[model samples]
Target chain A: MPKQERAEETRRRILEAAQETFASQGYQATSVAEICQRAGVTKGAFFYHFPTKHALFLALLEDWLSQLDQYLNPDRYLGNNVAQSLYAMADLLKAGLTQGRDYLPMFLEFWLQAARDPVVWQATIEPYRRYRAFFANLYLQGMNEGSLCTADPSLAAVAMVSLALGLLLQGLMDHESVNWEEAAPAAFRWVLSLMAPDPATTP
Target chain B: MPKQERAEETRRRILEAAQETFASQGYQATSVAEICQRAGVTKGAFFYHFPTKHALFLALLEDWLSQLDQYLNPDRYLGNNVAQSLYAMADLLKAGLTQGRDYLPMFLEFWLQAARDPVVWQATIEPYRRYRAFFANLYLQGMNEGSLCTADPSLAAVAMVSLALGLLLQGLMDHESVNWEEAAPAAFRWVLSLMAPDPATTP
Candidate 1:
């Protein structure tokens, strides 16, 4: 491989190592040395890619958010109708979360960091707001399409994000507390249906 | 003061100081020495009341959960009727979260700890499940009172909690992210209304 491609490969290995260690032990507990050892790369290589552990975490956050944006790209999911589309989004969230269960600890780590570190919070919130706005836009489109209820788009958007977060927390924190595979989407569908356009008005 | 009363008072002071420190600096960053100094109690006294910092945290969690239980005592808040009662709960949640905003960081800490520590997670999820069951019972009552619409009570209960968690997180992580003061309750009301009994069947 070319130099740039090899460099990129090294960066990816470092990130994967960091994520696996962080997920197993936690962000605070996982040392940079551990990440280097796991990645089979030198500390120099790791520092060259990420000046600090936090910078590496930020990179992970960016990568996760980009994947999320792609996964939730509205174009990729539109059901037979607007209401179904909303339900589809909920299922997509469940599928995504369930698939990412191995990294659940890392996700919680992000929340803890965001709550404590202003820099991490900034990185976390910017993406959160973008997703909120993205959902708000989708709800607005549903309203304009005249197939969704006329609830405040911003309010609905906030609810959608909030519900997703709540489900993720429950699923991660309380394994076997509930059959979330059933309960979460059920909760999502119930909330979505409340905001679903009146069936009487659907064209 | 009586011996027991003095002990209780010391405990309260330690908890208060711990909350203050944890909120401002976070759980991991806040040291036991700081908690002792802030509480104005000797380390001996601190150790007597709580064996470890983690124990102190669990005490705080227990105290917070008890307060929540008292605050959400259904009898304390029954609107003119059942449907209104559900909405009242939403408003109550908003009021509670807003009042507790000063300690939002600590709340997030609990979640992170729960995700990492099976013991903490066990403590957190037990109360969570109790609250979920409590809300589920209320929804089921609404249905039985012949006022609520026909819907699965469990799903509504799950949505209610999940939405609140999501809203609290947003309000905490992204200060001034949105007018959550308005958006949260509105979102809550929207979700509650969906589970409200059909007006046509009201006795």
Candidate 2:
């Protein structure tokens, strides 16, 4: 690999290592030294790549959100109607989760930070807003196309998103507590049933 | 006041104080000294009431579970049909939330503690089981009365419970970000609609 590519790869590795350490030890209890040791990089290298521990933490948050957005992108699931799109979104999340146990801890860490840290809250608020807006838009499309009910679409969208987050939280907190893969499909179907057009008026 | 009633009041105050301190400072960061200070009780009185910090936390958990149970009690909402009972349960929670902001932080603190601490998890699990059982019973009643669709009632019940918790978390975390009181009733009605009897076949 070229020198620049190698340096970029090292930066990614360091960020991943920092994420793992913070997930295990928590952000407050975790240290720059510990992250450097885990990454197998010198403190000088760590400092060159990231100026502060919080900066490294924020970098990890960005990476995680980017991956999440990629998972939930409309293009990936829009081939079918919006109902199928909803199902595919749930399926995509369950697939990632089954492969990414470490990701759950990072998610929990982000929530804890958002609850307590102003800087982290400011950084996360825009992404969070975008997520809610994206769901609202999907609901609006479904309603406009007559695929969904004419009820308040924004509220329906928020309810579905909240349910998904709650399920994800239950799974994360107790890894063995719920069979989320099975549950996820059911949740998607239930949400779809809400959006599905009424059949009573048909001839 | 009677001696027993006075003692109970003191215990309640101490638990409330400990809950607030734990929510603000976290369980590990909160010391017995701090709890006692917040409660305006001496260390001697604190120990007399509860032998240890863990014990105090457990007591707080028990109090919360009982309060939740009373709020969602079938007896309170049982006079009417199953559909009305379900709406009543939702309304009850809405009212409690409006009046219980001070306690909401403590409940979230309990969730964080359960996630990270084994002792707290043990204290929380039984009540969690009770809540699931209560909802399962509610769903069974709805099904038997033909008020709800003929699906797997238990799973539907679980989803409803998950939705409630998820909605509650969003409301708590965002703090009026969604205007949950208005949103909650709408969501509850949507859930009810999904459970509604199929009109085409019902008649």
Best by lDDT: 1
In candidate 2 chain B, what residue range of length 10 has the lowest lDDT sum?
A: B193-202
Residue-level lDDT tens digits of model 2 in B44-124: 989989999988988888887777777876777774567667766666546655756666556656655676678887676
**Model 2 chain A, TM-score vs. native:** 0.88
Predictions: Cα RMSD each: 3.2, 4.1
Native A-B contact fraction in model 1: 0.75
Report the lDDT tens digits of candidate 1 across residue range B1-203. 99999999999999999999977666777899999999999999999999999999998988888877887788877876677777666666567657777767677777767767777878888887887899888878878786677468877778888888888778767758788777887787777667674333357
Most DockQ-accurate candidate: 1
**Each prediction's fraction of true contacts recovered:** 0.75, 0.32
Residue-level lDDT tens digits of model 2 in A1-203: 99999789889889988877876666767889999899999899899899999999899988878877788788887745775576566676477557556676566566666667878866665565577778888888877775666467777776777677666665555555557678755765665666763232233
Q: Where is model 2 more than 4 Å wrong at Cα?
A: A1-10, A96-100, A124-128, A175-178, A197-203, B1-10, B96-100, B103-105, B197-203
Q: How many backbone overlaps does candidate 2 show?
A: 0
RMSD of 1: 3.2
